[model samples]
Target chain A: MSQIIKQEKKRSFVTAPTAALLSLLLPGLGQILARRVQRGLLMFGALVSIVGLLVWRITLLGRLAEGFWPTLFKSLDRAPMFVAFGLLAIAGLWLWIVIDAAKQTNPNRQFGNSIFVLILVVFFTIGWQISEIDLVKLSSDANEAWVPLSKILWPWEAAVTHDTDTVEAGAKVLVDSEGQAPPVPEKTEGEPYLRVSPRKGELSKLDEDNQVIPGTKITVYGENFEPNTRTQIWWSDSIGNEFRPRYQGEYVSVMTDSEGSFEKELIMPYRLIPPSAKGQQIHKVMARQVSQVGPPLPSQPLILTIELIIETIFMGMMATIFGIIFSVPISFLAARNLMSTSWLTLTIYYLTRTVLNIVRAIEPLIWALIAVVWVGLGPFAGIVALTIHSIAALGKLYSEAIEGINPGPIEAIQATGANKLQTIMYAVVPQMIPPFVSFTIYRWDINVRMSTVIGMVGGGGIGFLLVQYIRLLEYKSAGIAVWFIALTVAILDYVSAEIRQKFV
Target chain B: MLEIKNLTKIYPDGTLALDDVSFTVEDGEFLVVIGLSGSGKSTLLRCINRLIDPTKGQIIMDGQDITAAEPSELRRIRRKIGMIFQHFNLVDRSSVMTNVLSGKLGYINPWASLLHKYPPGAKKEAMAALEKVGITDQATKRADELSGGQRQRVGIARALMQNPSMMLADEPVASLDPVLAHTILGYLEQLNSESHISVICSLHYLDLVQRYATKVIGLRDGQVVYRGDREDIRKMTDGQFKEIYGEEAVRVNAGEFDQGEK
Candidate 1:
């Protein structure tokens, strides 16, 4: 030891200039020569990590192009300021390291390790640039999010709708009659009525190319409707499927005057009649107006959201039940304490551990995608994916619980002439109950949260509806789904916490 | 009679915990083993019931070879030889009754026991064991809810449930107070004399050993260094004490044992 110490002392006599030159070649090299090995290694690691992060950011910003130099140049071209900032920081660090290494052996050196603070500042700045953290953009572009965000924040408006009372009036028209056109319907007093000129004509039909062929022109007149009320035109085919007919890219709707009368011209809308029909087909055009609004009722989005949220809850529940059933046995196989007694058991332990780790390393969403492919899209797919992930996760947790149990009782029970299975039952199982209950509840909580997200990959739940609403820019509807998910998760967390307290 | 001939236990790590140990305990003998912490007392006790398989040994109990017993045979032999521990190892989460009942596992139907269906008489027997240990009132309580003395009493009751011919107590009173040590030993003595059950107990204090042991063996570094009967222990010399306890040990209150309160 003394001889090695003497040799180290002799090697530490390098001049300050030489030390500086050595550090200039590579950061921290001179510090190692100066006998500050730990400091030197730390400096080297910090420099490499910072440079690597900077390079990674550049590559990411460079459109992830192939090759380093091209990507770096492209990144520099795209973000000159960030590259310059990074380069300047590196230069500063390089100079500081050189200076520090030169003065490292000098007992009179005054500067504390201030380079660490500088390095931290540089790291933060690089992280800021890499993340594109822009407070200015956040403030300036608030308006774009405001439209959706405001609706999301207060979405009760979409939750309910008022019922309406409709006044209907219709007139029948003939379609390709053999002899003559049908006469106009006679009008009655004190009732809404509609009349058509030359009541019968050939109904519009699609040609071979599926283009509409305009039918004969006709004048339609309406009277005795609610005054100043908007009236919409509806057409029903021979099979009685009613739809609002479009005329020149607009619905055929008009406002009634104070006298409750109006006139409009229309072309008979195209209708498809089955070729198997044996008789002449008649089509009906109706003029409808909503005159009164009634009591409020749940909106369609609200109903659909509730239905899907229930499905999502059940998906989480079914997965958790399946997870518990499979993981309990797997956990025993995976537990090191229980399985370490023999070579065969030890192999089983390692195999179970590896399989669990591989399965758990993959996120449930990825599994959901695979499941969607296997089972097609539905809640069953979500349940399958969540169950797979939960089993792996719960298996690991339960095995850890088993490994952590007190071995004292196990020894005591074994000494009592209990069989191996009996020992586990009386000694190990008793100790494992609290941790098992706690972990199961925790896994159930995670499963519920994951079930909400798996639906985005077409696993049927509220998330499926949520993504669609988001895609369609239906923010209010999406907001309802989001609230339901958040509410369910919060409630589940509380319920699980309460249950854990009672059992664990 | 229990006879151990050429018993040796070398652990997997090559620790010679017991080396060529041999001893004999006649029926109804209250044999107390005296040794330092690592002097093979616990190992010897564990070896007798085959809790730990001896590296090499012959343990003959009433003409039966315990050391060479198969797994099923070993369990059957273990049940007849009850063992209590220093730490009072009761299943803390289980009711005291349940912990006591588990001691009867070797003799019960294995499948019925798996489903926790003890025979109708088993509970009554467990209650009787608890009554003997003076803890019948605590039968329904969780084992951990009891005091140290109470827990040890529960341990004794659990061992009693086996209806064993011989008992192994490994530093049974080491964790108890000085007074409670006598109380626990008194219970063992009563069982030894009144019920005619033999006891192989390890004790630390010389005063306690001299009071309770019908026969005594002292060990050091896994080798027996001293042997004495009740009369030899009462008149023990410092030279013999040093041979077993080493030169560094001091005999506190040498005059206390001469009085012999009983």
Candidate 2:
């Protein structure tokens, strides 16, 4: 009988690994190899169903080209074909493990340990395959390319431009004589005339000679200009219209040298002329200097400056400071350590918590609006909103932190003839520092992000610029603004994390 | 130093934890109240400090009736009479020094205490108490970090920090092993001897009680079944032990008592 038992054990041991191998090739095949056909089919069916669902969803979303579908199908599409092949493989593997587990004989019971390890290995292998099988990625090339492309194209830019003709007297100018200027002069009498003179246009006035006149002469000089280039000039007499070149004269334009310094003689327009009879007007002018070829003008730099970001940072900092100052004392009332039986303390705790929850529940923008109504617009409103919200949020967190402190020290301090307040200072406060620092830093991070958001409602931040860009349909600039915000938030998160780790 | 008259405690669940029990402990006496588990041992001890207020009794300590005292007055009384628990009830996270200092809290103003400006003397006193318990070296260590024996010593130090006229130890060594248990009892005995501070200790170990107690009191189902000298206890008959511990207890101890410490 003992000989027969030994032979049976040997046979089972030999088959276990083969069964495990079969299961690895196809899920549940090991169970079938182990003579549990029902369980094997159940597992096989579940895996196929899940894979099918994933593939179907991926295809529905038009992500098939990413190979998500194909991978899943390859693993499952040839239902009968792959299933039979996979089942056979898994059955072989399972048989191997079982046989190995059975072959170990020990009077000391170490055989149980070996069997457990083998079982763990088999489960781990099955799990790995399930996780690695990518049905969606197998379906579509488009999705495959788009997924990675989307990450790289996270931010986009757009250009915005506005035209302006006003020029500062000493600043450089562009002279466009043929386009939108006074009619060209017909060389009438020999009044030695200057053409295209470097000139400053008088504000809301006409010049002598019935032509719109330029203002004070500022020497417009450049490397390419001759000393005589500033001599010839042109003027216009149209009221409220600045001087314009009647002819492409020497004084009509001025170009700066490599050092950006220029010298030019400009005809000053008379300011004594009546302004426009209808409304306020601005006189315009251009200074051009003739050269062998016109020097390339520099393109105007795109400016996307916003004061809202600065305002938000300031508001957030102020709010955090005020919040800390105001909330710390209130937190003591809520802490069970300091006041154990005072109903007044309990009331204060709930009241502060409720107010805080209400403040937090409403978005910061709404708070900004409310604050604006109460305190008026600008940083003051933002500060008030952030401070109010911070008090509630910081209060709750601080109280909980105070609560978690070990009671032993409090009791010890109490035993020392220290009163309630003394115990709190010596016992509770010391233990609370770590969590308090951590929570405060985290709150500041959130406040920074919130500061930007609150700017949309005029609370003052980069959000204002983002709103304007979005409204103006400058999505590219808006994208740039969004990038700034995201970058700021990420940096803050990292910095805060570092600070919390170091201090807390 | 302390008087407990007609003290009875009934839990809210309608269970009679202590039935109209009355006892008076003289100053400087090492009084050990012995009983099996759930025999009003702890309830009787807590009643002295009003930690667990007796339902129908008056505790007159130092000529003041505490049973009718206001919350503030009760707190004042509590400060003067320190109570130790079986679990040592030391805040586990606090340093040993801090736990000892808490006993002096009742003497300082709340706001002053909040600032941790314990009069310099209080600090010295706290350290002295720790020294008394022989755990002065562990003053900076967290209470939980200490061994069970050390933790209980801290508990004693905490009680001593109160500078009370009387100390109430409710099964102080019930949680310790035999050796640690004896060491703690020895400390309490030594404290009683040197300070002449009245002590009312509840205990389960009959051996310890017989060894250290000047007087013995036994309770059965919230009623005092035996009260008197240690000599009177030694003369108790099998019937009396049965009355206190029930008949099943008698049968189990019939043979064991022969070898058991009387």
TM-score of every candidate's chain A: 0.75, 0.45
Model 2, A1-504: lDDT tens digits are 244333332222225556656666676666555544454565566556544543443344333345654644554553434333444544554454344333322112222234334444544544544466655666755676554344324534233333333222212222322233333233334222222333323332354667754554534333322334332233333343445543234335544445333555554434454433333232333333333334333222124433455566677788888889998987777676656556887677677667767876877677789998998766778888888888878888898887777654454444334445665566666678778888888888888888887867877667777787667755556666676677778988999999899754
Could you tell me which 10 consecutive residues in candidate 2 chain B have the lowest summed lDDT?
B253-262
| Candidate 2 residue lDDT tens string, B109-137 | 67665555678898899889988878889
Stretches > 4 Å off in candidate 2 = A1-310, A321-360, A391-441, A469-504, B10-16, B33-43, B62-64, B68-79, B87-95, B107-112, B141-148, B173-179, B203-221, B225-262
Please name the candidate that would achieve the greatest DockQ relative to the true structure.
Answer: 1
Shift of residue A113 alpha carbon in model 2, Å? 38
For each candidate, report what fraction of the true interface contacts it reproduces.
Answer: 0.74, 0.31
- Model 2 interface RMSD over true interface Cα atoms: 4.1
Poorest 10 consecutive residues by lDDT, candidate 1 chain B = B253-262
